[model samples]
Target chain A: MIDRLTAFVDRLRQVGVPVSTSEVIDASTALSFISWSERSVFRSALAATLIKNGTHRPVFETLFDIYFPQMVGELQQEPDSEQPSSKNDAKPLDDMTSEVLEALLRMDLELLDRLAEEAIARYAGMMPGRPVGGRYYQWKVEQALDMNAITERLTQMLGGSGPGGETAGSVLTALLAREDATARMGELRRRIERIIRGRLISDRGPEAMARALSRPLPEEVEFLQATSEDLAEMKRTIAAMSRRLAARLAYKHHRTKRGRIDFRKTIRRSLETGGTPLEPKYRHRTNRPDLIVMCDVSGSVASFSRFALSLLYALSQHFRKIRSFAFVDAIDEVTHFFEQAEMEEAARRVRTEANVVWLDGHSDYGHAFSQFLQRYGDALSPKTTVLVLGDARSNFRDPLAERLHEIRDRVRKLYFLNPEPHRHWDTGDSIVSKYSPVCDGVFEVRNLRQLAQFIERIG
Target chain B: MFESPDRVTAALKKGGYLSDAEIATSVFVADSIGKPLLIEGPAGVGKTELAKCLAEALPARLIRLQCYEGLDESKALYEWNYRKQLLRIQADENKDWSKTEEDIFSEDYLLGRPLLDAIRSSDPVLLLIDEVDRLDLEAEALMLEVLSDWQVSIPEFGVIRAQRRPWVVLTSNATRELSEALKRRCVFLALEYPSIEREKEILMTKVPDMPEALAERVAEVVRAVRNLELKKSPSIAESIDWARSLIALGRDSLEDGEIAETLGVLLKHSVDIDKARGALTAK
Candidate 1:
């Protein structure tokens, strides 16, 4: 049991979930207390001990299903006792099956899809016993469809000049003429494989399916193209990163600074050593600089804004005060929104209700800067650090370089985070170069790694 | 020590804390192995309540150390009573210097903090270190040392091992990530908001005088409010308070206007209250 638990932990670690040795021991101990027969109870026990962050729950569940499969017991109830005899049924080649074969032979992808569902269901039932894996099941289904034979039939039809063969010949000829026939074949193979895999998942469970569909590393996933699930996973990663950053900052401050020396205590200690002075202490300073975050929450850079705001919000405790603003063409003071709601909720509300996006639906950095200077300019001081997150694409409008320069002069530092790659920054509508000259630092933060490096440098 | 998870559940329930199978299993395992249990969750999910309940169930002395920023070993573990030591040194001035010095640094001059007290206690102890995430990394390191070894190493008096292994429960709101070293030395339990059914039971138990329908309505509303993106969702404790408030007002079922009026009992922030009000009105 310990070995199994350790192995499961190892898998979790492989999938980027950090699990300590003590956690492994705790999970094993926790397992001993639960009735192992109750799978949900057992799963929850291990999960509570193994998973520290909520984001890791999905990965942990996937790994759990893989390591401790409940399918073996489940499959026994409805055992596939029938032998693998393709010729046992009189209508062995059902109407849908024959149509699928015919469509494959004729290179009719549309018709093939129409019949593929029924064909897959029939093929799944015929395959006795638990599937070895998704890939093997895919291969079995492909073999049952006889893809090679269909390819050969198509080739033969293309080679012939017989009656009714001309139509098939033209279709096969057109398919062969395409430069991406191999790619098309690969797509078709994948589609069939998905059908087979989907059916197998219902029988065995989603664990095998999830294992087959690998996810990109959290730090590597691009923000703009990320799905909601990826965004959620990134949020967890950001949360963990922020916690570590806070701890690091606290440790640094704790190590570098000392509390004020107690003169009375020093004198009292001196009495023990005959008026010898030693062990001086200095006051612990809790002073943190004010932070002002200006984010671009327009269509192009919303993901980056969300992530940056969340990270900043998580570290809000470390700062004296953090005022956040979101803008496209207009600016809205979202500091209160963030302060009033949780990070997730605040981000959502900012998107929906902050009214940062103008009716024109185009990002106007010049307008946003002028608005910020007009309304919240007094809030800036020499002690404040202004952080801006945007792609700097202002739709060919006036580049508000001078307004930013004025704000930069008032603030201690102005750091701009551009989600676009550096190569594309100066091109198109992006006026990053215009603002880069006036800003203290312009970091091309395309992913979390760059974001982390930038954050560390600033800290 | 719990013989099974069910026994742990029964004991905790009898102590007025409705625990699920996972919590029961974790508590039982921590007791059986004599290791500390680290409970982490969002704020007000009863991470601290679990410790209190376990202490009540075990019928042991509950020694609590509420952690915060700048929490040091002197405050959490042990501190030498310097003034007492100094006075004793002055009083023993005529005596041999080394003898007096040694005497002043002994256990008599050592003021035991929560950790030291739990370790030295002969009675069964449930040491609840609340909000462990608030402690600085240095303080956390100090705690890790004592928790892992079940002993504190004082330079003058040497190591003081626990007479009996205390049932330690460290709770964190996850404001910060705890060090792996501290986490590894304990059993881990992640407590979340209870399900509606479990929460209803909790509301009823915590507010027995409240009507059953009112309790169910409070649980349902609290559940709905939690689902909304609120700044601070009503915790189980707040749900009980909400139920009690409703009972005090002579209301058996939640009314439309009253929900808007009484949302303050459940939600702390005005923004959250507004959001909950909007959601309730929309429903």
Candidate 2:
């Protein structure tokens, strides 16, 4: 049990959950107090000890299913009232369809489990050592059972309200019945997936299945390779993370205000106390820097730029003075959008309303930098930190390193964030080499984790 | 004080808080192992209510420390009565300075906050630290120190240890990420909105006069509203309040007219109420 538990902890760490040694020990101690046969309580015990963040629960649950599966090899044949009563009488799918429907209507979970097992054994064709994914087996089982027709029939039968009556009470009754049916069918479908996963785990082992099935957390998904779902999830994560950062920043700002004690002031105030320095005064330091963020809203790294802009503006209240600009071929200051709306809405307005495109839509770093200096050059002072976000793909235009150098000399600090990998930095049309030497630091920020780290370091 | 997870569940149920098996197991383990349980969830999902229910179920005296921004050690843990100390020093001015200083710095001038009060109490205590995410870094570190060893260190007086280990429960709405050292000392539970069935059970338990069909309807409508993209979804308390309101108005069924009249009881925001009205009436 200890060996399996340690292996599970190792799997959790591999998938980005930082389970410490002490937490693992806590989980091990929790294991001895609960019954090992009860999976729900056992899972709760492990979850309470291992997981600290709420977003990591889904990943932990997936890894938990792979490690401590529902069943090992095959179903232990236990006959009960719901079984078809003839031990080996092998009935076909067409005949048992009504039994399955009956079980679903009654919402008998144990009966559904048995039916799911029989269905997987007979129709899924999941052989040992097969390299098929779990989704394929689930699809096969879904097709063999004709689940769509079953669901439709179940819905029709379970709709308790009469079709002719359209009163509000009857409508609510129908809605509740439909919801009940959907929940029961969802349970059945989940059981089928878990049973298939169990068989596959016994065949392919937990590690292989874990590697094949584990979905990347939103932070781990690269910004350049994110799908729409990943983008939506990343936006939510950014909103929450920025809120926390803003809280911490507010606390840090107050902590720094009470600076070192001024001995001169303390002694001056203690003149009435006969040379006893009774009250010490602290030197108040107000040193919050100004910020200017320039994002490249071109075709390639548009999502990355939007996410970066959203995160920066969400914590904009903490800065002394902050300004934002969006650019492609031309540059436009977009600090007003964030001031009037939410971050997501502000990002949307930047794409539609902002005049970021001039002749063509390709990114031109030289023209944008010169345009920034021409318009907002006076805005850059010794207290300003300028952040530039883009891929630096200038479309074979001017590789203007001097323009960035001029901006670098005007600001307190200059940082470049490239959404591309470090290897793809100096490739065709990419002028990262021209910009890297001019800035204080050039970082490859390809994912949310890297973006958050860069923001923390600069904030 | 509970014997097992089953007893904890039953006691919570009797105390008007219906919990699932997962929660029961966590509460049991935290009690047996003597660790603080940290509960994180969205607002109005009953995170603070769980701590209150645990205190009632245990029949222990509740000592709450409500956390907010700028909460510090002196306000949360303990503080020195400076005015009293000054008065004592002035009254005994002609005496020896060292003896007067010793008299002023003793336990007479010590003010015990909630954290210290729970630690020094002879009776059983359920220390509820509510909204712990609002605590800044320094107070959080102080809490970590006090929780790990169950003792508070005062510079003037020595360390004050716990007379009895209190059952600590910390609740957060997840507005900020708590420090990992504080989280490492506690067992964690991530609470979400309850299912429709559980909501119905809660309604029936809390408002005993509510009918079964009305309770189910309220639960289903609340679940649907929660699934909508509203700014603020209806919480579990809102659901129970809506049900009780229905019973008060002598209404047995939820129709369009009734919902339009009483929708404000469930949804606080006007935009959410408008959206919920459209969705609920459209069905």
Candidate 3:
């Protein structure tokens, strides 16, 4: 049992959940106290022992389910059942499996999908028990389907079929032209694996499935394509991140640096030691930089704006002042909304009630910049850090890059967070290339990882 | 020590605290292994109350240290009674200065704070450090040595080890992340708001005079308020207060006016009250 527990902890650490040695010992001790017959009790006991941060709970639960599948009342068959059947091993591919191969040879994706599902079900059901270590059923089903033969046949058929044999023939040739047959087969294999994993999750438990499905690494999930649920999870992760950042800042703030000595304090301390200057006090400076955040709240980068605002609001205590503005074609100062409401509510109101969207509902970086300069330019100072979040997509309009440069000159530091990938920069109406040179830093923040790195630099 | 999680649950229930198995398991494990348990959750989720109940269940002395900004070793662990030392020095002016200084800096002149007090106690102790996240990093760093070793070092005396290791509980609202060095030395438990059924039982247990229907209504309203995006959701204690207020007012069920008038007991902020009023009225 101790070996099993330690191995489970190892699996958790492998998946990026930091389970310390002390926690593993605690979990081992906890396991002995709880009734192993009650799965929920056992699971919760382990969770309480191993998981310190709530964000890591999903990863811990995933590893727990994978390691302790018997707790969920699945995969309990004898170990020998996992071995290949002697009769099936002696025989070649069956007729139904050949039919799937035939469909794949014709590049009949529709027919192949149906036949693949049937073949997977038939082979997976025939498996005596769940495979350990690797995905046994998926590999077995793939081998049985003989996708290599289908690929070989398709290569030959497409080579002879010229450009006008049929729509399917042309589609196969076109697909092969874009990607080699080997790569296409690899993609098909991945699709089959996904199906098999889905089935396994359903058979194991829905609770595990729910956690596993949404447990994408926070840095890897693209903000643009995240669903509302994914956004919520991301928000939770970011909240944890901001708390960590705040703690670090607080730690740094508490470490009083040795500045110019205070002669008066030193003289006063000399009195206690009978005119011997024993202790000296130094003057320390507290740098609380004012922040001015201007986020583009148009449809394209609204998610990024919301996420960044939420994170900044979490770390609001570190700054002396934070003034926020949202813009599309016109700019609107939404700092009051944040002061009047909670962070989430303020972000929502800024998105809906602010006059960021103009009549055409197109991003006008030039108009927005000119308005900000005209209205709130006086707010910028040498102690202020200006953060501009957007894709810099100006719809072929004047970008007013000069106005950004002017703002940059007034502020102590100016940062540009472009949510679009760097490869997309300078493409279409994105004027990042024009604006990048003026800012202190222009970061490609397509996902949370880059955003966190940018914040760490500024923070 | 509690024999098992079930025994801990039974003991806590006997002490009038309804604890789930997870909390029971955490308390049991912390007691058995002699590690501190770190409980973090939103405010008003009974994180502190769990400590109080554990003390009762263990029938031990409770030593609480409320943490805030600028908490330091002098306040948390120990401090020298400088005034007493000064008086003693004046009285012993004829003695050698070095000997007098050594005598005054001894344990007799030391004031044991909660941390030191818990360690020095002969009886079993439950040390509850409330809102630990509010402490600055320096203070938290000071705690690492004492908590990890169950002892305190005074330069005047020597290391003061605990005669009986106190079961420790640290609660946080997560205002800031705790250092990993602090977190790793403890078992962690997160206490969210209970389910409606479990909450109804809690309400009935705490407010026995209230009608069942009224308890159900209160739990329902609290659940609904929790679902809304409020600055602070009504905690279980607030729910009990609201229920008791309704019973005190000679009401058997909720009326819109009564809920409106007594909403302040549940919702702390005006913005949350306004939002809850809109939600309640809509309902």
Candidate 4:
């Protein structure tokens, strides 16, 4: 049990869950108090001790299923001679359709489990040492079961004459029954999937299953490579991340603002308080830097620019003054879009509403920089920090490094954020080296983690 | 003090908190292993109520420390009573300075906050740190020593160890991520909104006067509203409050009119109420 626990901890850490040594000890200690007979409690014990963050819970649950499965092999039910013919093991596939419908209608979980196991055994082609992904097995089982027909039959049985000849009360009853049927179908599907997953994990040692199944965390997913689902999840976390960033930035500012206590003031105040020195004063620090962000919203780096602008817009409360501009070959300020609507809406509006494109819509960094400096030259000051977000691919245009140098001279700090890989910096029309000398910092931020680290460093 | 997860479940049920086996198992393990339990979830899923229920189940004295931004050690852990110390110094004028210093820093002049009070209590103590994620990182760091070693050390004074280890339960709405070192020492329980059946059972337990059918209906409607993408979903507490309000208004069954009328009890936000109303009517 200890060996298995340690190995599971290793799997968790492999999947980016930071489980410390003390937590491992706590988990082992927690395991001793619970009975292994109670599987839910056993799993809960490990989860409580091992997992902390809520986002990591899904990964932990997946790894937990692979490590500590409920049943090892074909689950053995109690043998009953009285009802042998009706048993799932003896029943043929022809009778299974009705049996499955009946089991689903009754919501008999054990019967569904047995049916799922039997269906996988016959249909999933689960031979020893067979190398196949778990989803293929699940798809096979799903195909064999004809789940759509079963659901249609179940709905027909549940709907009861199609609610045509029903009263208001019976209509409500049918609606509730249909809802229950949909829930049961969902449960049936989940059970089949779990059974297939368990069979594969047992066949292909858990290490390989862990490798095949583990997904990159939302923060680790590259902005350029993110799916729509990943982008939605990232959007959901952006608000919370921004709130945390604001808190951390405010805390750091407060800490710096609290300078060392003045002994002279303390002594002066102590004269009135019988030399007790009860009240003390400190030197107050000042100045919050202004920020101006320019994002290149060309096709290649559009997603990266969207995320950067969304994060900055969400965190606009922390900055003293923040102005955001979106550009392709032309530059236009889109800060008002953020103020009028939410972050996602603002991102969408920046594309459709902002007049950013001029001539062909390839990313012409030289043209955009010159346009920005021409239009907003007076906006830059010594207390301002400017961040340019793009891949700096000038598309064989003039490699205008001097305009960036002029912008840098007017600002306290100038930084460039390139979403492309570091190795891909100066390839082809990429002119990052020309701008690197003028910029204070040029960071390669391909994913959310690096973006957050960069912001924390500069904030 | 819970012998098994089953016992924890039954005790919590009796204490009027209907928890599933998972929550029961976590509470039991935290108790037996002498580790603090960290309960995190969305707002109003009963994370804070879990700590109160555990206190009631154990019949222990509940020492609550409500955490917020800028809540530091002097407010949470302990602080020296400066006025009392000053009086002691004034009273013992011309006495030996070392003895006076030692006399003022003792237990009489030391003010014990909730954290220290829970540690120094003679009886069994259940320390409930409510909304712990609201605490600043420095204040959270201050709790690591007390949470891990069951002791607090002041530089001027010696280490104040726990007389009997308190069962610590920290609740977070997860507004901010907690430090890794603080989380490493504890057991974590992520409490979500209860399922429909569980919510029905919760309604029955929390408001016994409501009819079983009506409780089931209320749970189903709340679950449906929760499925909608709204600003704030109705929490378990809101469900109970809605149920109690239904009974108070003398409504036995949940007609569409009844739900529409009392939607305010379940949903706090106007936007959520409007969305839930549209969904409920369409259903």
Candidate 5:
């Protein structure tokens, strides 16, 4: 049994999840409390046993569901059946599962697994969903059949208008070419069509039953850009390394002085000085960066501000000065966030501290641009490099194209990194189409990989 | 010690450069501190190679522990030699049944796996704990005590401490983030994909038979193709493969014309091949 559990986990590893041994112990301990006589309950119990944190809860639940699927009758509205009930309509999802289970129990095990899958899939398709324009008639016909063997009852209900008015069987035959694994999956998939509920997973992704048999979630983290301090440190380190002279620097040039001066350096310096009486001056050097950065940490783009701070922290040693600011409806200097004892805490304080009336959390770039013009347009000189990270969605407010036009004149380069996809640029409050024109460079950065490329390009 | 990012790149320029960086250099430090090194990287980025190379550098025997899900101390440490135990049991069956249980559980019956094998070996060994991510948390936690002490406890043997604590190297593709408890015990190194220049150097070195110009073109094509939205990008191994495939085919320049069927050389996934094919023909 331990070996079986071990094999079970080994399979989970074969997928993407990393399971440690303590979790296995916790799962086994949890399993001891359950009665395996009931498979669904036992499955839930095993999940309860193995998984510890809330973060891993969904993953464990998914794995559990995949491993020990409830048989048709087993999935009935008993105490622990995993049949998901819609908040609106409570009862009887798997009438077919129970019907097939009742029909198949004590029958052939292989046949039971097969037909139950078919009937369960069919039942799954009829599960509640929003009205698809074409599927309404099919749903209605199915609803009729479900209501009063409505396939048969439709004739009387229709007052003999037309007998051939899309029978359920003909509708099924006409639509979705349902056959073999495609038919099975098509049925299963239609049953588990993606929820519009705005969540990462619904019970609909592929191999749900297989994923459910395990303990917890898979690992997926992308590290494209470092936290701001780390980025800053990398920048600083790179700068410091740059000055060492990859091959050689003529630092020890000879100097030939008047009366018995240095021999080697005296002669070398004399050559540069036409072998005249000259002195060799030694100046120690380390690589460093000479540049200016204009960062926009406005509340609209606050999600990345934390990382920006870390970058600033890392580069604190390399640069002479870094001029940073935050804006909501308006731009305000908030470089003090990096200077503060706690960067996150400071950002919070700044958010509250500078809650000026114009600076709204929801974006208003027109006002922000106008404020930049009146307040600090002179600061965006040609030597400065401006990096703006935001959705560029100004919420249907004025696009304020003229102000960006003026600021573009002052800054040497303006780079834009929008988190939103390119297609969504002109959709709603998005000023991406308008803003893309003024910026020197524009790139979509939805993940770390893109961000790393962006940083490398800029650096 | 890896001072410049360029130095790291330069280090990776050679052929057989394993992408085996841990969570931080702490793993490197721990290895230097004479503790076991736990290295976790994706499947093909060469976690095992780091140990192999390090073993070569150190000139020590590489003792590897291949971890599976249900890995236990009995398997990782020492297990009773059942054939020997059974032979003894049969031999002692008629002599004295009373002392049979104790006699059968003696050290003579114990057989050593990698963990115990590393401990008992007179010479220094590189104990590679490959794919630590596959093992459950309990196994990881159990590993902590041994990792710190360089010893294993067996009731039969009383305690089997390392005669010469082997250099332990653990690897993972990050199926899960290791616990802080386990992490604190080791040094770290986070391996990332190499840059274009470094990758080019790697290609030239790994496939020395490859034409230099062809290798450069391949690296460029790989980088450019990688820039597009594909299912998965070509890894370092894939770069080597594409070079080898090209070399075997006796092709030097990657003509725009050759990309259609030769896309299988670049893209691994069918969808990616189709996407690349579409892009190649798009203009």
Candidate 6:
């Protein structure tokens, strides 16, 4: 049980939690005092030591409960007292699932947790000695796996396999739940893609990224690091950023006095003061620039789109009227998802709403740009700013500058925010520079600072 | 950072700030009318102080929030004083319990942080969410929730809305990227180390007592040492310390001879000192 507890702490550190050797010591000492006969007492003792920080408390508790569960027989479950060779096992996932299933068969909670971690780690990969955000996500998976183990035990008692025999929706859900290898890889690829794409596009300006990221002290990183990876947290962060960006305005608040005067306000105020200018209030009708943000939500840029759209959505919120959309090979309007509520549901809606009717599902700016002109050209007047966020990696396809030229005429500004580095701008089937001439503005958005500067400048 | 928005841009153009892409973005953002500037960046690049300078330039009060390890609604936004409520309850012990509970959790006892205080203040307030990256995901979510509406929700008290939308500046160290929800709430700026020329200028202006030649040398050594892939990068704090140390020692110039010896005046770790020494010698 203590070994299981130690292993759980190590796992927590991987996900982003700061479980120091001292913390492990505290947990071990606390564990030694607990009466093993009483399961509840033992659990609390471990929790009191391991789960110290306020932000980290919940995840630790969740992980601890999942790892150190209550079962029918604890000692009898593990045969021959020797540990399993987790490192050498090529099929850690298979081994973990099978071992956990066996633990479930025997109804041993502590062993189940160790096996559960092995299962999570099998797909998630071994975390470095230090904790990070990715580990937090895996930790969330661990929490769910704990719950799943309990449910599976209950199901086994009732005579069944994993979550109904259908193996259709539940399979994807279960697969997605257990060691989401694809999503994790996709997330990493998306970050690298954005960082790269951000470098490739036309310059937003110097200090653009810097202003967006600088701070006086550590905040979320500290919290995130302390807590470790919480999948729920990762989801929440992505969702929160997405929601903010989706409805974000170009202008937070505008008081435009550009080559004009407040005739009505000036006249009304003068009249009120008997033509003696008591108070000259400027006529400021806040202008919320309508945006059409289209991203190549392909495999590489999917995660970027997730965040970019969220930020774009956030920017949209500032405008009196704004609309947002996302595209992989095809386009779809997802502006309705700007609200704080229904964010995760919104990410789900991205797939359904994006009409997958492209001839090729690769990067085709020509196809996407042409589609916009044909389907929505009537709405593409000078009043609107057409923003395209992509790597512009058309996979060596015809870099059609014609459609882009047409977009330049129709829209007030054609801005392309790319995530590729500058060196690869003209390489790898990427036709970024070809479309650059038509774009009123172009930028490389690598991090928060770059993204913030991009958003700040537009409206 | 370079005195004002204009100066900062100029420094960028002169190659004072190496990252040219961000300068154009800054000009666009500063020139932008009627937008609550949201500046996020790494620590020591100046997030709260930007607002302070903005406050100095515009002559506004710099309302600030120094976020901590476990900052919450009561600390960051508003919280009712139960202690005051207890005193009131003792004074009015015979009064209705249900009515008292409702009355006590009202605006009368609502305390304010930079967020609410900036909103409630009649004067212009440059609201700074300092070290916002320190806030939890929940806290960031909470701040985003407030930023979206420019109004905060208090179950006990009513929604506290901004009378006049205050100038808001949020700072963060990409310790973790903020939620897009938070990002969309305002304008964005990312700050990194100022270029050697600008840093020297900054040093000259901020610390006039330091010698001009010494300041230039300080900037060069700091910038050079920072470029190395050490365990910990030398920060602005180290630069200032190095300058102060040089002056305190009555040293006329920063020589290679003395530099390798007393690196503790600048770097915190011996490994970093070794790294700096290696970098300096390699140079």
TM-score versus the correct structure, for each prediction: 0.72, 0.79, 0.71, 0.80, 0.38, 0.37
Docking class of 5: incorrect
Encode model 6's per-residue lDDT on A303-356: one tens digit a residue.
Answer: 566555555544543344566667655666667665332344566666566674
* Winner on TM-score (2 vs 5): 2
What number of clashing residue pairs does each candidate have, in the order they appear? 6, 0, 0, 0, 58, 84
What's the distance in Å from true for residue A2, model 5?
Answer: 49
For model 3, residues A251-285, the per-residue Cα lDDT tens digits are 33433546788899888866654566866867655
Q: Name model 6 segments beyond 4 Å from true.
A: A1-459, B1-36, B96-102, B209-211
Q: Arrange candidates by TM-score, highest first: which order?
A: 4, 2, 1, 3, 5, 6
**TM-score of A-chain in each prediction?**
0.56, 0.71, 0.60, 0.72, 0.40, 0.48
Candidate with better lDDT, 2 vs 3: 2
Each candidate's lDDT (Cα)?
Answer: 0.73, 0.80, 0.74, 0.80, 0.53, 0.56
Q: Model 2: per-residue lDDT, tens digit, B1-283?
A: 6676789899998778999987898888788777899999878899888888889999889999999866777779998876677778778989999998888888888999999988988999999999998876677888986787999899889999998898899999776767779888889998889998899999998997888988887888788677655556788998889999999999998876788789999988775677677666644
Q: Best to worst by DockQ, what's the order?
A: 4, 2, 3, 1, 5, 6
Candidate 1 lDDT tens digits, B171-233: 987766677788778777878899767898888888868677777667766776776654467
Model 1 over residues A1-459: C-alpha lDDT tens digits?
777677777767776777877677767766766678988778877876777655567667656665666545443333243223332542455454456546755668777664554445446443534546656656666677776654444444443544343433333233332212333355567566645544455555554555664465567677766676777767656755655454434343544555676687677766654465644544466545677888888877766776767766655534437788989899989877766566777778888888776659789998899889999999999878888888999999998789999999998878998888888987999999899899989998877667666755664
Instruction: Write one digit per residue (lDDT tens) for candidate 6, span B1-283.
Output: 2233345445443432333234333423332323344555434665555556655545468888886545767678776665576677777799899888887787786777667888788887777777776565666776765565677777766677878766676666544445555554444454557777777876666564888887976786676666543334666656777777777778877666667766787777665677567555433
Itemize residue pairs with steric clashes in candidate 1: A258-A282, A259-A282, A259-A283, A260-A282, A260-A283, A261-A281
Per-residue lDDT over B143-171 for candidate 5, one digit per residue giving the tens place of the 0 to 100 score: 88678788888765588787877777777
- Kindly state the number of residue pairs that clash in model 6: 84
DockQ for candidate 3, C-alpha atoms: 0.22
Q: Candidate 2 or 3, higher TM-score?
A: 2
Interface RMSD of each: 14.9, 5.4, 14.2, 5.1, 26.6, 26.8
Q: How close is candidate 4 to the true structure, as a TM-score?
A: 0.80
Residue-by-residue lDDT tens digits, candidate 3, B1-283: 8888889988888777888877888788778777899999888888988899889999989999999775778789998876677678778989899999789888898999999999999999899999998887678998887789999999878899999888899999876667889999988898889876678888999987878887877786687678765556799999999888888888887756677889999988887798777656533
